[model samples]
Target chain A: MPDTIAPRSADAATPPTPRMSGVGRVLVAVYGILALAATGRTAVQIIERYDEAPVAFTLSGLSALVYIVATISLVAPGRVWYRVAWIAISFELIGVLVIGTITLVAPDLLGAGTGNPFGRTSTVWTLFGAGYLFIPLVLPILGLWWLAKHRPAPETTGASATSTAVTPGASGAAA
Target chain B: MIAWFAGVQIAVAVVGALLAIILGLLGRKPSDLTMGPLILVELLLIVQVVISIVAPLVGNEPSGSLLEYWVYLISAALLPIAGGFWALIERSRWSTVVIGVVCLAVAIMVYRMTQIWFVQGL
Candidate 1:
C-alpha cells in the first residue's frame, strides 16, 4: 500500500503566500540594516535634541518606524505581510521623495539658525540620505522592484486545483 | 576605546567581510563550515564592547555623548548575531552574503564609534 498525503483546504493552498527566499533574503538584510540604522540615528537625535528640532526629530522617528515595519513585513509570511511590505515600501519611497525635496529646496528649514521650524537636516532622508551615502534614496526603489517581482500570481479558475497539485513540490523545494 | 586597537579590529572585520563576499560570489551556502570568520568578527565585536566600557573608565573619555557611544557599542555587538540568525534560516548563498553585509555593517559601526570618540575632538 502506498502512503497517502493529507489534503489541505483550498483557502490554504491557493493563496500562495510568498516566502522570503533567494533575493528576498538580501532585501530583508538590507532593510534590517536600515531599520537598525534609522532607529539608532533617531534615538540619538531625539534624546540629544528634542527641543532643538522637534519636527525633524519626529520625522526621523517616523522614518525609523517605517523601516522597522518594512523589515518585519519582508521577513514575515502570508498575503497580509505581502500587502504590508507594499504599504511600508511605498510610504518609505514617499518619505524619501518628500523630505528629500524639502531639504533640497529649503535647506534652512531643516538647517540650523534662522529660526527654522523644522530644525536641522537630521533625519534619514535629509539631503537625500547624504549622511548615509544616499542609500535611503535608492533602497525603496529596489524594494519596489523586488516586491513587484514577487507579486502573488493572480487568482484563476482552477487555481485551487493547480495550487493543490503544486503544493507538495513547493514544500519539498522549500524544505 | 583604544583607538588603534579598535581600528585594527574594524580593519580585520572589513577583511572578514571581503572573505564572506568571496564565498557568496562562489555560490556557497552558509553552514558551520563557513561560520568561522563571522564568529571571529563577533568575538572581536564583543571585545570592542568591553574595550569601549573600559576605555572611558581609564580616562579616554569618548568625545561624543557617552550615551551615544554605549548605544553604538551594544548595537554593534548584536549585528553579527542578527545576520547569523537570518543565515541559519535561509540556508543559501544569500545567507552568506548577509553575513558579509553584517560584517560590513560592523566595520562601519566601529568606524563610527571611533569617529564618535576621536574625530569630534578635533
Candidate 2:
C-alpha cells in the first residue's frame, strides 16, 4: 500500500511549509541576530576574562550554542530539522526562564555581583534578558508557537489527499 | 567613536525604523520606500566601520576595552546587511517590520558602542 502511492505523494508532502518564508523569515532574522550577538559576546567573555566568571561565561556559551542551533534548525528543510527546531527552542525557553530567575534571585552565583570586573551582568538570559530588552525571554515562546502552528504534514496514511487539499490553501493565503 | 557621528547614526536608524514600521503597518511589501532608509542605515554603518578603523589612529582612542568596543561595532554593522538581505528574500510586510526591528536594534547597539568608547573606561 505504501509503495504504490509513494512516488506521487512524496514530492507533494515533502515539505508542507517552507520555514523560512513570510513571518518565519522575520523570526529567523531575529534568531540570527541573537546567535551572532551571543556568540560574539561569549567568545569575548570566555577568551579575555574566563577566570573572572567561569560559570556565567559557560552559561553564556550554552545560550549561544542554543541560539545558533535554533537558527540553523529553523532554516533547514525536512522533518528531522523541524524536530531539532522544537528541541532547540524548548531548551532556549527553559534556559531563559531558569537563568533569568537565577540571576534575579542570586546574582552572585553567576558572578554578577560587585566582584565582577564588568560591573554588570553579561549572560544572554541575565535578569530575564533585560540586557537585550527581554527578547531572549520572548523569542523562545514565539519560536514554540511558530513550530506548533507550522507543523509538517504527516507522511503516512492519507498523506497525499490531505497534502493536496492543504497545499493550495496555504499557497493561496501566502499569495 | 566620534560623538556626533554616533548621534547621527542613531538618529538615522531611529528614523529608518519608524519609516519601516509605518510601511509595515500599512501592509506594504518591501519596496523602495521601506528599504531606502535601511540602505542608508547600512551605508552609515559602513562609514562607521571605516571611522572605527581611523578614529583611534588619529589619537581618539576608546577609554573602554578595545575588544568590547570593536565587537559591538562589528556586530552592529552586520545587522543592517542581514536585515536587508532578509527583506530582499522575503519581500513581505513582516520583512519590512524585521528591517524596522533591525534598525531599532542597531540604534541601541550604536548607543552601547558610544558608551563603551566614551564612558566605560578600563
Candidate 3:
C-alpha cells in the first residue's frame, strides 16, 4: 500500500487525501511558522498596549488564532480535519482582505504611536502581506486548493482504492 | 536577556543550522542530534530565565520591570521548541531546512532580547 499522496489517474482508481506533497509539506511548514510569528506578535501587542488600538489588536489576535487552528487541521490526517482546515484558511483570506483594506483606507483609525498599526511590516498580512510577498496572504488559499484537490467525492473510493492501485503489478508510481 | 547564556545559545543555533545543512545534503538526518539542539537551547534558556527572575534581587535591574523582560525571555524559548516539534514530526529534508532557518531566526531574536534587556527602553 502506498501513502495517501499518489497522483491521480482515471482507471476507476481513487487516491486518499495526500498527507504531504512536494509543495504541500513546505506550505504546511510555512503556515506553521507564520502561525507562531503572528501569534507572538499579537500577544505582545495586546499585552504591551491593549489600550492603544483595541480593534486592530483584537483582530491581530484573531488572525493568530485562525492561523494556529489552520496549521493543526491541515497537517493532521483526516478527511474531516482537512475540511475544517479549509474553513480556517478561508477565514484567513477574508481576514487579510478585510484588515488590509481598512488599514489602507482609514490609516488614522489606527491612532498615532500604535506600534506599526497594520503590522504589515511584521505581520503575515501587511501591504497585502508584501513583507512575505503576499505568500502569507496566498498560503491559506493554496491550502484550500490542496485540500480541495484530494477531498473525497461521491464516485471515488478514496484511500482504499489508492492502496490497491499501488500494487507492483498495478501502476505504482504516484502522479 | 541573560547575556552569557544567550550568547552560548546563539552559538548553538549556528551550529545547529550547520549540522542540519550537512545532514540534509547527505540525504540524512541527525536523528542523534535531532533532540540535541533543543536540549542545549532549553538548558541555556532555563539559566537565562533564572537570571531574569533574579535581576531585581541583584538591584542592577531595579529600574527595569522583571515582568516584561521575563515575557520576552519566555517567548524566545518557545520559538525553537515549536520549530523542533515541526522538525521532528515531518522527517523530511525540508524539515532540516526548516530547522536551519529557525535556528537563524532564534539567533536574531535572542540578540534583540539582549539589546532590550540592557537598554531597558521604556
**Candidate number achieving the greatest DockQ relative to the actual structure:** 2
Candidate 1: residue A127 Cα off by (Å): 1.7
Docking class of 2: medium
Residue-by-residue lDDT tens digits, candidate 1, A53-127: 677778889999999999998877655687998999999999988888887787658545212222233688887
- Which residue runs of candidate 1 sit more than 4 Å off their true CA positions? A1-19, A111-121, A153-175, B31-34
DockQ of each: 0.40, 0.56, 0.16
Candidate 1 fraction of reference contacts recovered:
0.52
Ranking by lDDT: 2, 1, 3
Q: What are the clashing pairs of model 2?
A: none
Q: A27, model 3: CA deviation in Å?
A: 3.8
lDDT of 2 by residue, A34-133 (tens): 9988898788878788887788889889999999999999998767789999999999999989888887777788774512323434788887788788
What candidate 3 gets wrong by more than 4 Å, as runs, is: A1-17, A21-26, A78-80, A97-108, A115-175, B3-8, B18-26, B33-35, B60-72, B79-91, B115-120
Q: Which regions in candidate 2 have their CA more than 4 angstroms from the true location?
A: A1-16, A112-121, A156-175
At residue A147, candidate 2 shows an lDDT of: 80
Better of 1 and 3 by TM-score: 1
TM-score of chain B of each: 0.90, 0.95, 0.77
Highest-scoring model, lDDT:
2
Candidates sorted by TM-score, best first: 2, 1, 3
Measured with C-alpha atoms, the lDDT of residue B6 in candidate 3 is 71
